[model samples]
Target: MTDKSKKVTENSDFIITLNSLTRFVLGAVGGYNMQTKLKGVREMNDGSIFNSSHTLEIEKDLLLFFNTWVDIQGDKFSNDRKGFQLVTTLIQALGLVFHHIWHCCSNMSKTERTHQIYIAAKKLAQINYSRDAEHWKNCSFLTLNEDDLNYKVNSGGSTTRKHFARYLCSKIGFNY
Candidate 1:
């Protein structure tokens, strides 16, 4: 594929995968959810019991994965946002998945722990993603009605999203 086409493809994968994983964290698999997007919580869906220890462990693991992925992805995807944004677009989507999962995307800081993830990411990547973070400084960064459910991202139809979903599954020790 041409360089431009390759970029588009890669970026598409990144977004689709990100959205799927975020929804999974929010307890959705069939499609994207906006109403209960971190606004609601239900029983654990990972087949594992929900306890303080498990939750803490998952948070730690997710944060580590986010940082490591960003550090390595910068080489593969592109400069800026640690290769999270493979192409130039209006959306600042690099750390968005993490925010979405943690429900800290709102402009108003959600909690000390969630806010620290952003700080920690900066410390680890040594890149200033403040602009993108500000852009997504809301409960939902994707509001065009396009980034969540449509575009064949979260419906179990693509390889990239599938891979991310599997990773999330593994994080919870869920056999998928």
Candidate 2:
């Protein structure tokens, strides 16, 4: 076979295997197939107990696998649109799934957190995200200027909203 045809076959096979694995993992955790999706405290069609701890552990393992796979194979798929999409979608979906699980398990949901940040942000005039989230998280910056304060990098996802809000506050000489 030509190199391109061989690569296409490999990519197709990988996609099929990944989809099957995702369905199996979801089913094992919730006792229902992915088609009939369910999350925390939601009723499964089969009425089986959803073992959340087990699910988290399994999901953690999958997360690690995906992280490592991306680290190793991300470049191989970069030039191939289908392969890149498959890899990225798998990683993004798994990240979102884990985030949802974390939100369900946490006392504070992302929305609540964002609201709290919004209230804090109201005190300051800054509305847009304009600082590195790590500054707020660490809360130990030797010196910060107005220009340095309101810059956003790597700011997306539920967890970062609060961080972004805090960053915004920091830009206006507010410590959050």
Cα lDDT tens digits, model 1, 1-176, are 13223233433433324433444343322122221243345335455433355446346635564556466446533434332233222112222334334443335444654555545444434432233332232313122234442121222223343333343333333333
Model 1: lDDT of residue 118: 46
Off by over 4 Å in 1: 1-39, 46-54, 78-160, 163-176
Displacement of residue 143 (Cα, Å) in model 1 is 28
Candidate 1 lDDT at 111 equals 60
Please give each candidate's TM-score.
Answer: 0.29, 0.26
RMSD of each: 14.9, 15.4
Using alpha carbons, what is the TM-score of model 1?
A: 0.29
Q: What is the C-alpha lDDT profile of model 2 across 1-176, one tens digit per residue? A: 12222122333534334443443355334432331343455454456555565566445444443344344444543434333123222333333333333333346665554444333323322221123433333433212435856322243333342333244335544443
> On a 0 to 100 scale, what is the lDDT of residue 141 in model 1?
19
Query: How much does candidate 2 score in TM-score?
Result: 0.26
